[model samples]
Target: MIVRPRPNWFRMLLVVRGSVLPAILPQLLITLAFALLVTLLHGRVFVWKVSLTFVPFSLIGLTLAIFLGFRNNTSYARYWEARVLWGEVLNDTRSLARQALTLVDGPAPSRIFVHQLIAFVHALRHQLRGTDPAADLDTWLSDEARQRLQGARYKPSAILLMAGEWLRERRRQGELAAPLVQAMEVHMGHLSDALGGCERIAGTPIPFTYAVIIHRTVYLYCLLLPFGLVDSIGSMTPLIVTFIAYTFFALEALSSEIEEPFGTEPNDLPLDAMCEGIQATLLELLGERDLPAAPKPVNYVLS
Candidate 1:
């Protein structure tokens, strides 16, 4: 989700202040210390000459790089696809709100029902993040509806089903004609599809064995890199290998962090904030005096 160009080295040092650093720092120091030890122990015996690569190191490094790249790329694609699907949800929610304002008669319970629909959006958002849904619902929902969702699992889907039932009932009564009810139900169906799409992404993940293999290979590369370079590169082996190792491991960690953007990480996708957009879009149609502000972005990132 980070849209900025890859930072230069100076900025990168600052930007890596998150999870990647902790994983990299230890490997770097270990490489450095061992590099120094080799220089002290073999400084006199080996010439100043240095050889950069052993055939196997190059092969192994390339293999790891290609495989890791493939994994990360696939993961990012899945993450971005999820984002696009959620964007559709936002657009469809707006469409639903527009349809509600135009089709439903403006009267007694109309304002209340429409506002409750907005509450359902917020409720769905909080539910997805495993956050408490009880408080966000009260302002938009009837006491009974709020109670139904408060302790329940699948909060968003529950509210959605309620909305569907409301439409069905209106159709049964003389209030809303069958055609209008069907049109509204179509939007409701989109809501259901969005929920299903999100659930699929959340449930499915890259195989654990694949992730484990990638991790183990990265560590092994870092560990064995010194042996390949120490004899020829001498004192420089540690620093050089560590630098190279840092690049490999850092990319690996970053990709894994963003692999499931819905996850609760500083770098994860901003579902809560997207849900806020839904609220603003719906509430504005109701022409309420006061509307809640949209969810604010963090330092630079949204959600």
Candidate 2:
């Protein structure tokens, strides 16, 4: 995601990062050109009085705006829910690390738990983004663990299962006491819930019917607008149509970008940086040196 300070008004007008202007530029230009042609035709083409009034357009515009607002809100809710789920990931991982460090009797076993926790973060990030996690997981997991994860359908859940099994093994070996094992199990459940939540969001999306209806409505409104404005706005029809088209089209584009919330879009969540942060925190808890550096934003964008 773009991670810069807010720009001043003048600079903000020209800012492109995290903005949908680029994606909608073609649509805006086309609408402007159409409006220009309509204006030159003087609301008539080839002896045809092709004209429309502003009244119906105005009423439709109001309802269209409301629908756009609703769609945007729905998209933002998905985005925010994704953020919240990742927040839970960070919290639960930290909590698990703390429990393992304090309750587990041996540093060797505790370090294994920490490595698994860190690997789980990377695994979840890779799973959500649909990227290969072999490189990320190889360093933290043993050859056997890594091989077992290879070709696994749900790698993050597979990693979490390993972690839980490790905890159960330790408990059986009398390394972790019953009460503290129970505590760790609770945190493990939180991790499981977070994984399930992210998967649910990634799999499910805003209804297709709503998306189709809103998409057609926005395009129809933008295309029909020039007909309504050319006779009334006269020479200024192009500018007005382009501005309105930009507003409507940009919103639609942004909603589509954020609705998924896991892709590598400029506005999508920074899963890489988040996973790195989790790794750093968990490794520090395990007193490991030579920790990987936290991810830094490039060109004011983090991912």
Per-model lDDT: 0.73, 0.89
Q: What's model 2's lDDT at 11?
A: 97
List clashing residue pairs in candidate 2. none
- The candidate that wins on TM-score is 2
The list of candidate 2 runs beyond 4 A from truth reads: none
In angstroms, the error of model 2 at 101 is: 0.7
lDDT of 2 by residue, 102-210 (tens): 8888888888878988899998988898888889888999999988987799988998999999989998999898888888889899889989999999999999999
* Span of ten consecutive residues with least summed lDDT in model 2: 42-51
On the 0 to 100 scale, the lDDT of residue 196 in model 1 is 82
Model 1 alpha-carbon miss at residue 46, Å: 16
Q: Evaluate model 2: give its lDDT.
A: 0.89
